[model samples]
Target: MKKIALLVLVLFCGTSNAQKKKKSTTNPIVAVIITKTENLTAEVIKPNFYIFRNENSIKKDTLLLKAFSSSITPTDCVIKKFVTKSTPLYYVSWTEKMNSETKLKKETIVVTNVQIWNPATKMQVFSNTQTSTNIKEQVFLDKNKTASETQERNRNEGYNFTLLPTGDFTLKNKAVESKYNLNTVTMKYELPQKSADVSKSSKKKKK
Candidate 1:
């Protein structure tokens, strides 16, 4: 009888623990790679962004600092970009798919793809892909929905900055906040190997 009671108590404890865990959600951590692609005209580069976060609401700006400290090579483009001396560049993507395709009403999936590029090298540096589905799809849905309440889909997407001191990272949603101060961020290039060449280029352009 004692053993039966203990077993029941243990089962109850386990079930309660599982319920508690389900109630809490982990925040998404991410790095957005904002870039000025060659195709991007001056007008489109407005309010570029790079933000990081953990599961909670806490913002993590340190990821940007760490990325600056990391060094990237040409080959590392598969995961992150480091070929250039300056500028944060990335891709944008947003789409949806049938979550469970069948004859009747089809479920859907939301997805986004983005590419990061370095203007100086004219090479893509990093790209990130993400998907959100299930009940969250309704929340992820675009605000501009149709009158029938079907989601009005838009392809607008944001990129994650992948450069890190270690060349690898998993952003936490609680660590970052959306960046809105683009004008304040210092955007400049490292000095070239020779000043004379710069002067010559300037003179030629003037002529």
Candidate 2:
């Protein structure tokens, strides 16, 4: 009876330890959704999106959308299916003004509107808009270069581009933060390498 009692106590302690370990390892789940639209363009622009949980990358996907004559409709805008655990950060980078003339030096304006929604309640919790503008100058001035050579030169030089702001949330109201525990979640955003466009082309070649 003494031996049996000792054995049972040992098993209970082991089980309690295991339960504690499991609880420590558990992480919170986060879903990342990305949507894109061009102001005035005929071609469909499929952009690449990335998600990171803490400092580690969790998911990478291409945002593919149906071709629209002028602008993307509400139904055709969003690309979601990425789900991750722990704290999540999301970002997307794409070339804008695909149809614009690169030879002409002009100012390019990019407007980004961001909205964060509560998945459980299906309500928007935060919204913000940012606009970035840059003047694009003629990079390759060699007229003797062939069309393909000019294209190659243009490809090597990163052209008109816009980077969407990283997905991070901060609750303005103390009550909301306390109720949701959103303050515990942290997000970090990093700019893509300058060779991102070249990498994009490489991916296309592989596909």
Candidate 3:
């Protein structure tokens, strides 16, 4: 009888400990790339975008916007314009608002804006504004700690923008594209590089 009682207690403790363990979660960072192609023009153009944000608002809220051109060639005309003329081919902004008491319990309102221009001519080509709602859930392992996992639902309106080699922009949502020219616009999701990798690349470039 004594042996059986000890075994049951051990089993209960093991189950309770297993229940206390929390699973880990990850939040991924993604990037948007826009490319343009035209049937008449053989040259494929990939324009760079600049991002601007309200620092004060970001500090108070969970909003953030990060944009940069992937161009690394020093001799590229786009790089030259960016360095000497301080011109950006595109401008983008992102904003978000919570619609419920708990971040995980409710949907969020998201607004995205993009403005395109001719860098050389400095003429505005077109501007677009999109408003949509998304649901983001974050799970934490402990109180006041960072989330272990994060999941998003109905994000970005299920739209994927593609820039055909022919210099035309195609959006998965045709209705939105009909009103605006989405030329040379797309987005991508990727994991961030480690600091060590970044430093090594910088060192190689310097050498």
Candidate 4:
């Protein structure tokens, strides 16, 4: 009797641990790389987005997500203008699988720093927030009246900011509230390098 009780207790503990592990979630981080910066305006050469645990998620709808940049990019684009639509410069996502037929589900979300870095100026802009929200999704198939699923999930997402044309942006959310601010201010004291001309001067001689 004593042996049977101990085994049951062990099994219970193991099951609880497994359940907790299954419920764990991971958040994605955001970033951008600006390859060009002329005057105050700039261009993003590449954007780097890092997502955690998105590979294992399942999706029933692509239009269910709402994500955007709290502020526009420092410069304007010819094809698409900023601030009109939810910007795609930042991304946060996670994946889930409901069944074998369900490949992978992705949610467009945000949970942390939204950053833009200009390597040319060595200037970086970032959001100051650690934000998260709970997501509940219920799907009902029109064709199959009885087919449906309800899912409750935690989504990580992020902050608001002010983009400065001078290669800087101000975060609307404070570090204390979001715990995403720096104790030490970011230094940008370096003066822009002056160009040197090796070619012959266009100016004619005084003679």
The numbered model that scores best in TM-score is 3
Instruction: Tell me how far the alpha carbon of residue 198 in candidate 4 is from the true structure, in angstroms, after superposition.
Output: 57
- Name model 2 segments beyond 4 Å from true: 1-105, 136-207
lDDT of 1 by residue, 1-207 (tens): 999999999999999999888877664444333332333311111122332322344443212211221222111122233333334543333233435544323455555444544444444444455554443123323556432233334332333333335323332233442221112124322223354476689899999
Once model 4 is optimally superposed onto the true structure by TM-score, how far is the C-alpha of residue 114 displaced, in angstroms? 4.3
Q: What does candidate 2 score on TM? A: 0.24
For all predicted structures, in order, the TM-scores are 0.25, 0.24, 0.28, 0.24
By lDDT, the better pick of 2 and 3 is 3
Best candidate (score: lDDT): 3
Better by TM-score, candidate 4 or 1: 1
In terms of lDDT, which candidate is stronger, 3 or 4?
Answer: 3
TM-score of 1: 0.25
Scored by lDDT, model 4 comes in at: 0.35
* Worst window of 10 by summed lDDT in candidate 2: 173-182
- Writing each residue's lDDT as its tens digit, candidate 2 over 107-186 gives 55544444333333333343344445555554554576433222211222212222223233332232322111223233
